[model samples]
Target: MKISARNRLKGKVVDIVKGATTAHVRIDIGNGVIVTSSITNEAVDELGLKIGADAYAVVKASDVMVAVD
Candidate 1:
């Protein structure tokens, strides 16, 4: 409910791909852009994440990396 991270992009869940331990939660942040977060399968279940549901992609500035190719 309360987080310190400022980079919170609200969007609708587009897809969910689950692996052995981690799952990739894809959220469409609008404008044909999607933000994917790799989280534990348990986290995904606990959060009850499903397609067409609202979710937020929380990003920490310190952990973000920029690459120029």
Candidate 2:
């Protein structure tokens, strides 16, 4: 599928935590680095995401903020 996002990291689905309306999907890119994304449960089912499934973490954000105290 064609996408507008450029930051696409290929990885494998490691874990999935479902909530009432949202779900956390974790993907292991490499070297013990994992990225978690919170999306709707319906999206999870539509994508057929499951453990050991290969997928891409499509990162398309305008700004990423980091704060430390």
Clashing pairs in 2: none
What are the runs in model 1 whose C-alpha is more than 4 Å off? Answer: 67-69
lDDT of 2: 0.92
Measured with C-alpha atoms, the lDDT of residue 18 in candidate 1 is 97
TM-score on alpha carbons, each prediction: 0.90, 0.86
lDDT of 1 by residue, 1-69 (tens): 798887999999999999999999999999999998999999999999999999999998897889999
The clash count for each model shown is 0, 0
**What tens-digit string does per-residue lDDT give for candidate 2 at 1-69?**
797776799999999999999999999999899999999999999999999999999876554456899
C-alpha lDDT of residue 65 in model 1:
87
Best lDDT among the predictions, by candidate number? 1
Task: Show model 2 residue runs off by greater than 4 Å.
Answer: 61-69
Give the top-scoring candidate (TM-score): 1
